[model samples]
Target: MALVNQTGSVFWSSNKSTTVVNTVAQLLDNGNFVLRPENDENPEKYIWQSFDHPTDTLLPEMKLVWDLKSGINRFLRSWKTNDDPATGDYAYKLDNRGFPELVIFNNETIHWRAGPWNGKRFSGVPQMKGVGIMRFELQENSDEISYSFEMLNTSLYSRLVINSSGIMQRFVWVEGAKFWNQYWYFPGDKCDNFGECGPFGICNANPAQMCNCTIGFRPKNQQAWDLRDPSDGCVRSSKLDCGSDRFLPFKNMKLPESSKAFVDQTMNLSVCGEICKKNCSCVAYANMKITQGGSGCVMWGGDLIDMRQYDDSEDGGQDLHVRVAASDLGMFSIAYE
Candidate 1:
């Protein structure tokens, strides 16, 4: 039998090859709504489920992914309005152009970026580090890259979502209050907006001004910069010389946009730097995995984009080394060894 309600019948299945039989769909107390064989109660045998087609909420063990060949994905789209269940202006999606990064798009433009993953969590979203109750996992394979989280205690309830206003959030159910309390949310400040400081710019909300160009960079449009509009981004203060360029190390930084980076899972950090120094097109490089003492490398060949400064006192940051002009390295009083 199909599921019917006052609104009408809603059949939940992403696979067209599925056939309906004597099965029952049950919404478990753990927030999982599953459809399984009528005679088989074990969840591992579930043939179809609403959890797989999550509209806006991400329950425990649910995943957000990007696939190149199959194009199958489970992402969140904002509701059109507070009163409607229609598609809206923003979409929370995982982009795998080069490496994988979680991005929120408004119409076809990037509105917010969670930054690329650095093994443990999204490079920019230090807050995503699961607390005592929640545990997180990220997996990248030959076919796809995905992120998911599980509850350390199955009895507790937690959910993540891309809300209508283009913000990503996580909420936890408070049993006594019988409500979901906001655990955290993203795009929390002006600096959190996608590319807020523009190319080669690093944003820090705590600073008097959130925007500043990185070493060896200058405003692309000084006129627009004076008007407080940095969308024009930045330009390198000097041209890169592949033969003698030096790397400026920034600790506890959210790495630049990765869609244009060259990713290789086999190279170590030393080899990554050597290879990057040999490529005149390369601008920056960083380890892909922070765990296991680091494992992969992503070398950005295009203009570095969407970088931000994180409060190092908090937690979870990556080390990024960007190729710089020899004179610029001298500005920091460091030898270009």
Candidate 2:
């Protein structure tokens, strides 16, 4: 069912509702249109809400969620075109399989990823750390996992949307200019494409050769790599010696894809490293939070993917400790040393 405005545009849409007598509809201050029992003033008991079934735009205070109990996922889908409101080919959603990460999909295929939440922001989106006007939140519990943001100033308006062109963009309303200014957009560069450098490869936006193997690894197919293709990624130069392998630190790194990772929020960084060392399949580990010198633990198993290195001057990228053979440690110095 959809609510049509005076101008004939869809004001809101949701699943068809059963007819109920004496129900009341109200638009709340936070922009939620809710249906409730006439005598009930509580939001928690609302029978339905527009915010729960958003279209393309993610308004302030609107949540993109995954409800574990119901197995329902709420996400943004781009419109087919600027003039048509039909469902489009792109979607912006949260992947909660392991550690949760924001990902954009073109139909069934991944287009880009805004890596896992690292306490302050998504690990891959460094610019989010610098946005002072918006207060972001990531909530995870036994019942649900969700992400949302609200403007600090009530007078300001901003919306995050997946456009028809398949780009995720944020726009802020400019009062004086009487227009919505594009604040940010993602798939920001060639490197931002999902797994642009494939597994065990690191991408640098500023480099002429955008993709390179991590320090202790070599291109899996040098011939393909020399021809400007790196889809095959890299392989370890020396096989890990199980018990004696070292975790080589890489600073200012966009942590690898996390859907197959292991996470323990109770553990510290040092304990996290020890846990990774014990697992033969563990490829990398990093802190979950970069605040107050860092806290929590996240360890990745199997090959690492979609990793990128940011400039040293950037504020938010985290350190990733990659497992390498002891013999290979002598070849590459610890990053940032």
Candidate 3:
């Protein structure tokens, strides 16, 4: 009824008194490690398992929960050192503030984030698309808000790790190579850094000057922007005229952070536009699910932050509609019709 730590201490325990004569701990074929009586061979018949108590690594079918009312959260904290299993400063937690987003924190500061999950996938993690390895899902209902994934190909092995340095990385085990090969990592470059370009600004890793204001937007602080410091973000060139305001179709973009997002899952893309138009605070909107002709809506109520251009030929790009005045749109003005 207890799980031992590396320090030979009882780190966690069920505290259930048992008087079983013979018991055994077994690692099942489905990657579930369970504890059961020696006579019981089925995992469903087991009592405790390693999947229920996760450490730094997340395996297939394992869930990460962030409940609102109950305050029962299951998250991962990095080891104190590379070889030490003790707690560290870096942590990965499910932030359910506005919408649900997975964020890595260095102590208490936001170090990196896998942007909010649309009905399909996380906006910042498009690499999972067409991978043919995992089937990921995001569940948010009245009871609880959680993120979980299962392997599409049962033979394949993969994991997500929050390293000691506060980097979130995904790796696949290559049997022939007999090693774990990492294909993706968060904070991969300057662009992945939380709000590198501030708000209403795009971070392009390929560009010599990584940070640039979005179309119809100007630097909030021109002096700082001219000095190669764009932390002040951007400001709209023209004010929205409510009914007449048009949406600028921003393509191949990582959707902005959703802390100030107004999400309505029942609304279609057209209805989303109508509602956004009615609300003066709504600055932008996007289709949460880009697959199957697109569905659902995500509306940004305030300043949009942490948006960037993705390089994935087709899978990674999203069409974001930014509210703009008719006059500033130029040729794009006529296309709004």
lDDT of each: 0.81, 0.87, 0.82
lDDT of 1 by residue, 209-266 (tens): 6788877888999998878888888888887677868998888788887877889888
Clashes (backbone N, CA, C under 3 Å), per candidate, total: 0, 0, 0
Better of 1 and 3 by lDDT: 3
Q: Which stretches of candidate 1 lie over 4 Å from their true place?
A: 4-21, 42-44, 67-69, 331-337
Cα lDDT for residue 168, model 1?
A: 83
RMSD of each: 2.6, 3.2, 2.9
What is the lDDT ranking, best to worst?
A: 2, 3, 1
Query: What TM-score do all the candidates reach, one by one?
Result: 0.91, 0.91, 0.89
lDDT of 2 at 221: 95
Q: Which ten residues in a row have the lowest lDDT in candidate 1?
A: 11-20
* Model 2 residue pairs with clashes: none
Q: Largest lDDT belongs to which candidate?
A: 2
Q: What is the Cα-based lDDT of residue 328 in candidate 3?
A: 83
Clashes of 2: 0
Which pairs clash (backbone N, Cα, C closer than 3 Å) in model 3?
none
Local accuracy of candidate 3 as per-residue lDDT tens digits, 104-203 = 8899998888887766777777777767778898888887888878888888888988888888878998999999999788878888888989989998
